[model samples]
Target: MTNKTFCVVCKRDDASVIDMQPHLVRCLQCGAYEIMAIEYLQMTNQEQDPLLSAWIRNRTEEQASPPLLTSSTWISLRASLRIPNLREKQAALMKAFARRSMFPGTVGRYNPVADFPLAWAANEGELRFLKQDLIARQLLDNEYTMGGSFLITAKGWDYLDSIPAGGVFSDQVFVAMSFSDTMRTAWTSAIIPAVRQAGYTPYRVDAAPHIDRIDHKIMVEIKASRFLIADVTEQRAGVYFEAGYALGQELPVIWAVREDDLKNVHFDTRQYAHIVWKNERELEKGIYETIVAVIGRGKSH
Candidate 1:
């Protein structure tokens, strides 16, 4: 907490601040997050964006370490930040309720003022409106007390169950790699089976029967996939480009390369851990373990 007395993300002054190794700011509006003083001070009041605020609030609600924001991490996050559409916001808010009230008819308190970020709302008024909309739709019970508590209706659970695993990327993994004659074994013997073993659908754009524009199809498939596996074995520009697009969408990208090609990776992406393997056997095992670690085993086998 710099002596500034206002939240770095939303500029709300009433937030609780703890000056520590990574300054902890428990913002009622933006939720809790750890930020280095340097980065906190670097943010100007004009930099506030609700999408960024909502994402931080989401990380806080996950009950994991509050996401630590730094210059490097912000580059991609800031670029990826976009206002979510109305239906998406409502879906997120309902999912938040589902997280709290696992079963129907369980009351959970919501603070429109503090938890507005949960709905990706710009303010408390918007959050109130969203709540009322849900109530009107019979997806949530009306708040019973002044505390603004609510419960999901049975219909709400049904609605949630009907939705996909995520707004984007529903347990499908997009594989970005060289489709070269030498790399044939890498795709068939390594990447494909590795993704399948991790319980997710492995999709290589070329493997699909799409007569549409290839680039359009690639972009569409990338958005539909949960994460990306970028095998830079041949250091192909297409693989790097696809991985960059995935990063911009905030999808996790696992890096892999042939041991001999490891030295050829681009300078910017070199910082990430690479699963350098001597052969397809090692590549398969490495990619499988990394997928399990980065993203837990997917439900769609």
Candidate 2:
């Protein structure tokens, strides 16, 4: 059997033999260069290779555009440009550009643990603090509290970078958030899930509570949230009021609406691009872009 070579970066199989090195092959499609072995398992695991990450960065360029769907040659040209330290710098630049492009969007590479490094808790006290925070936020939920032993919800996980341990967690609580209800049924369902997916927990204030309360908890919560979202369905009064309140608080609010509804939307509102969605897929994609914008803003600041 012939040795199979694959580009570790793009994860493609289109490779070419190199004249200089008999054992090494190049991904002609995506510019991923590598060496392989005849036995399937013998190829060095790219992730495990200490130098591979750095090498990938050195081998790839910053301006290397995203692969075009139509061209295999374009696919092969995407060099793995992410060197560890260099990758951070690249991320920062990308973040800065993203910040300028939009507000309150997702940032970084979208790590599942929301940026948790491997083997995060080496000591007991640090682990204990994480548990306390999770409980305080009601993320772990009392039903499953394991005496400072449990997992965190997405909201809880976002705070990991804020943890004082100088790890990925930061100390910032809910700096900003977005909310909207005057949306198409499909879009309404998509927005919240997308917000959560972006790693920001958006609280829906659909029903107003009793006007009198010790903390004006609902409004206060909105105030504390760093941003807001309002879906204006052909000028719903409630949506306008809430959006106005967030704007008054100087919170970064994003408006979303259907295409037909835009005709009746106010000129002032029109000036600011209301995130529009024709369908659920578009709504999710919009939300992801918004998340990137939010993350980008955070990084730049």
The candidate that wins on lDDT is 1
* Candidate 1 C-alpha error for residue 26, in Å: 2.0
Candidate 2 regions exceeding 4 Å error are 1-184, 207-218, 295-301
Clashing pairs in 1: none
- Point to the candidate with the largest TM-score: 1
- Tens digits of per-residue lDDT for model 2, 41-74: 3332333222332233222222121221212322
TM-score per prediction, in order, is 0.55, 0.37
Q: Once model 2 is optimally superposed onto the true structure by TM-score, how far is the C-alpha of residue 82 displaced, in angstroms? A: 29
lDDT (0 to 1) per candidate: 0.79, 0.43
- What number of clashing residue pairs does each candidate have, in the order they appear? 0, 30
User: In model 2, what is the error at residue 22, expressed in angstroms?
Assistant: 77
Per-residue lDDT for 1-301 in model 1, tens only?
A: 4443588778888887788877888887777777787887787444777777887886566443466777667677777566776777788788888887746777877776778888788878888787788888888876642346788888889988865543332567889988889999888998889888998878898887645678877876786678889988878999999999999877889999888888888999999999999988999999999989988897654
> What local lDDT score does residue 129 receive in model 2, on the 0 to 100 scale?
51
